[model samples]
Target: MQNTTWGAIMGQPFGVIGYSNLGFVFDRDRIHEYQTYWPKEETGLARDVYIGFKYQCVEYARRFLTLKFKAAFTDIPHAHNIWALDIIEDCTKEEGTFPFVNYPNGSKEPPQFGDLIIYPYSKEQRFGHVGVILNVNLEEKYVDIGEQNYEEAGWECPEYARRLIMKIENGQYFITNKRIGKPYDNWDINEEIFGWKRIDFSQKQ
Candidate 1:
């Protein structure tokens, strides 16, 4: 799969679907077609940073944080475990950590851009799933997210992988599993979104 700006959605398994808002989104349908072990040397990342398995949802979240904020959390056992994290290690500068905030699925706090959206564990996704929130459209009632290993199709938009419906009730936010259209995958009510985690940059010194 070539690393182009945009990928061709030719229904090819394990091919380059396209570039997300930050990192490349690869098709994770076929396990035999791609390498799951992505070493730091192979990924061109710092030796200390360990982003999860290659093309997994956690990998995209960590890689997005690393590329955009120059920070990342420690290795996690699963994608949903990220809800327990409170800070992210700074990859550059002072080598310190930045505190992050976790908002639950039905929180009054609305999700902002660049937040790490997490999905819960279920029969469909045993390891859970995570993605970067690209944009939040309260008016349109949808959120544009970028992720890998979620769907095996190409992105419908230039900057996002998929769009999930977001509804506000009594001033509380809820990101539903019901998708708008295109690149259909296995997202359903059972695969509920746990919430989103955002770095509090103001805590940075």
Candidate 2:
């Protein structure tokens, strides 16, 4: 029999691995279901939900990396390591500018297993969004990360294929937006067991 604690999410494209409880093929191999907070529908409720999910997803992604890569993982050691949303926001911590702390840049050292991915909403470099590098390859420049409400949700846009398109010729990693088609039981649930942490961090205090 199959695992049935929760059901795979529906209405989206991709499968949920009941084992990990992560939503898949959104913009990466996996993204936190918390993203439901700021859905493409862009409803007021969605935005409100995003406020809490961002931070939780941040920690979740970090934990996921640590668990998946084990010895091959590098950590982001700052509470503010997440996206600034507003550039003027504080980034005073020494670690704020440190490696793997903030970036679209990959760590040149060991645990080079992944790179940092940033989605810039505004023209300025200090805001918008951030995500971790999931995978990369020279022949196929594709990146997979935990992301939400991708601007294109995997479509073609000016200068490049927005959303899920992986770089074919440049860049150090292979990043791609998740493509959605007919989904198979998309609902995914976690944290109901009581010991799970309810993460909340869309904006730092």
Candidate 3:
């Protein structure tokens, strides 16, 4: 297992780390930046669709969908609220929406690449958390995810922020925040993962 301990270099701007896969940058968010009001001038958008805060976890997730999958979702109150969504806006299609399926934690279905990993509200994460799965390696029993505002550490791998353990038991897939028996996730793993949400493009046609 790679050392979980991260070193922050001095003079880094707002704890900004480099980009995680797909040209989406992740940051440390050291100032605890929060803006209760969304100004049209400050809101980040792609193709005129809202993409949440500048460096929040939700921002990265939405940006991933926009740039990679040509998908969009309307404003959500919190990151955890994403799980309740039933459809995703098809940015490339006019007046179109695509079905989004949720696979709760310990479900029979395993998470796939491009799925959005959602976390429930916990004491540590008041608004909850969200991340995009970059890869799922069943053979290696690990899942690599990319996100922001979760950890200050630089990428453990070139394309991912961190890796989590995955195991299958009795045909059900389960995820643990730990990477190879050691705690690698920064949040409280006890809250457990709510599950993953995927845009079912197969339903579009």
- lDDT per residue (tens digit) for residues 91-120 in model 2: 222121122233232322211233335443
**In model 2, what lDDT does residue 177 have?**
36
| lDDT (Cα, tens digit) per residue for candidate 3, span 61-107 | 88778767878777899999999999998777556889989999899
- In candidate 3 the C-alpha lDDT for residue 71 amounts to 85
lDDT of 1 by residue, 124-151 (tens): 8798888788889999999988777665
The models' CA-based lDDT, in order, is 0.71, 0.29, 0.71
Q: Model 1: which ten-residue window has the lowest total lDDT?
A: 9-18
| Regions of model 1 farther than 4 Å from truth | 1-47, 183-187
lDDT of 3 at 193: 90
Clashing pairs in 1: none
What lDDT is obtained when candidate 2 is compared to the true structure?
0.29
lDDT of 1 at 111: 95
Candidate 1: C-alpha lDDT: 0.71
TM per candidate: 0.75, 0.32, 0.75
Q: Distance (Å) between predicted and true CA of 189, model 3?
A: 3.5
